[model samples]
Target: MDLEAFRSLPEWPMILRDSWETNAGWWQAGFTEGSDVEYEEQIKPIVRVGLGGAHRILDLGGGDGQLARVLAADGASTVVLDSSAAQLQTAHHRGSSVVLATGAALPFRDGSFDGVLICLVLEHVVELDEVLAEVARVLEPGGRFLLMLNHPILQTPGSGFIDDVDLGEQYWRLGPYLREDIQMEEVDAQIFVPFVHRPLSRYLNGASARGLMLVRMEEPPPPPGFVARAEEYLQVQEYPRLLVLHFERRP
Candidate 1:
């Protein structure tokens, strides 16, 4: 796969350690201030994960807890956890109950939470299996898990390179989405957090191994801004912005 040069030149990691964590900091500032597209397409739907009741929801990579706050407002008991102090500060400032922590080694006890939401989170974790194990351990029997992600199939390295379609500047011009082997490290300048694009089977099998059952897996349709942005490049017939999943813990 031929990858174009990485953009966001001088690529610096924002105070938020991971992708969503930085986004949470932005969300703390009314979100609409910047990156509203991500906020709309990525964050909002997860907030509706357990819309009706007040289940205890743990926002796994939930930076400033924007989604946690929304869930809390809906009367759900919510806790946002992230590794960055800056992001946690933003989360608290935004009125969310948040913890400064890493997803791989969560601080909560086993079976402590009723539900867990890993929105745009695992992509950044260096230890995906550890994080999934922690998530499974924290959830109670029959609890739910909702995950949001840019689909690996469409985002795979070669998916955008087909000649029949011109992915335009933005789509055609970014990291090659699918490449099994990639390595880089930049701590202070860029987030040291690594990203992986394993197929859906990787996620499903891991969850099953940990005694979690898939209740639902949905490709949430993109929001208006998302649709428009994609249109600028190509007609996006089937790229999922969010993977709304529901999983139940071992009974």
Candidate 2:
């Protein structure tokens, strides 16, 4: 539990609130942008298989409840918990039951949820240890925890898609993989989104310490048509972009 080195960002909460509040519309619009290819071909297949037997599910940081609505339609009693009020409003508009809450402090009783889905959210969270601990606290014994992250290796600091004409290939340049830092990725001319670059060991060890047993994991490539969109997508196909992990709360 010695997290003295990886301290949480003091300004992250305010930054997150401001970013989402100002760019809620833009976030919602791109929520399901790659639904046809990314979700259907890669992510949803794993989710569909992993969540097969679960009943009660919590979509932690389920912005705009796009994935929450899909989980509900599949017969799971689903609830979306997000920190952004504007995102919650968008989720409500989509008929999803939404709660405005951060993952670090979940207002739920122990063993309340039979399953949890945390997709692409941890990168933005500054309080990584707190959130993972809360995820363990809210899950029932043997409950499934399906997590999706931007692949740590592929999305590390100082990494980018490069179309090398001299090398006659498209590839990704990656380095400084172990350095943990806060990064601001540009979303629009006036907006930038914050993400924390954490190593794989941090995520795995943190959850393992809390008794979440990893049962399944995948580093899936982008679907073929993804390469058609841009030359950057070609590099994504070559390297892993998404890390899908399915863990079970130990009894």
Predicted model with the maximum lDDT: 2
Write the residue-wise lDDT of candidate 1 on 1-251 in tens digits: 11122223344243225454444434455453245676766566555744446388899878667777777777889998888777777777768888877888899999998888887666555456788899899998877777766676554433443343464334432344435422332323543434455667777888889988887778856666766764443445355646666777878
Residue 59 in candidate 1, Cα distance off native in Å: 0.5
Ten contiguous residues with the weakest lDDT in model 1 = 1-10
Q: What is the Cα-based lDDT of residue 40 in candidate 2?
A: 54
The 0-to-1 C-alpha lDDT of every candidate, in the order given, reads 0.65, 0.81
**Which residue pairs show backbone clashes in model 2?**
none
Q: Give the residue spans of candidate 1 off by over 4 A.
A: 1-35, 41-43, 158-194
Q: Local error of candidate 1 at 78, Å?
A: 1.0
lDDT for each residue of candidate 2 in 46-138, tens digit (9 for 90 to 100): 776777668999999988787776777788989999999998988888888888988999999999999999988898777888998999999
User: Candidate 2: how large is its RMSD?
Assistant: 2.9
